[model samples]
Target: MKYLAAYLLLTAGGKANPTDADIKSLLSSVGVEAEDERVSALVASLKEKNIDEVIAEGKEKLASVPTGGAAAAGGAAAGGAAGAEEAKEEAKEEEKEESDEDMGFGLFD
Candidate 1:
């Protein structure tokens, strides 16, 4: 991830295609030690690709992904019975507390 960030920083700074040295230098400038293997891998993976196009493609792919509660809440809200069960449990707990208080037992006693 650090390697990727350095690469993007160089690209944003007008280095259309950042080299391994450039990535390592940029990372070192901010007190980060760059791993040679990871830097090389990142450069190789992004060789000959346009960053802007890649980001645009990523955005398009993400746009189709579900990012709302509907999909996540489907299973939890199934049968619509959780609310009733939760209410019953809450009532039982309240009754237990009231009975305990009615016993007139104090911690100091």
Candidate 2:
């Protein structure tokens, strides 16, 4: 993930294609040790690919992912129901407390 982040940073900075050494240098600058095997593999895999095209493909793939707005609405409904129940319980408790009071039978009465 770190390697990929560094590669993307370099690519975003107009490197177009960042070498393994470039990735290593960036990681090392942040006191991270780069794994040569992973770096080489990453370099090999992306060597023939255009960064822009890859990002576009990734975006297209991500477009089909569900945001679950319906699930969120259901959660909100559940939360609201819970809140209403709490309010009712509080109102009941208040009523009980009032009934336990003097109930208009004061000293002057």
What C-alpha lDDT values do all the predictions have?
0.88, 0.89
Q: Write the per-residue lDDT of candidate 2 for residues 4-63, one digit (tens) a residue.
A: 999999999889889999999999999999999999999998997998898899899999
Stretches of candidate 1 off by over 4 Å are 87-109
Residue-by-residue lDDT tens digits, candidate 1, 52-92: 99899999999998887776578557736886688789999
How well does candidate 2 match the true structure in TM-score terms? 0.59
Residue pairs in collision within model 2: none
Question: How much is the lDDT of residue 108 in candidate 1?
Answer: 62
- Displacement of the residue 77 alpha carbon in candidate 1, Å: 4.1
TM-score of each: 0.72, 0.59
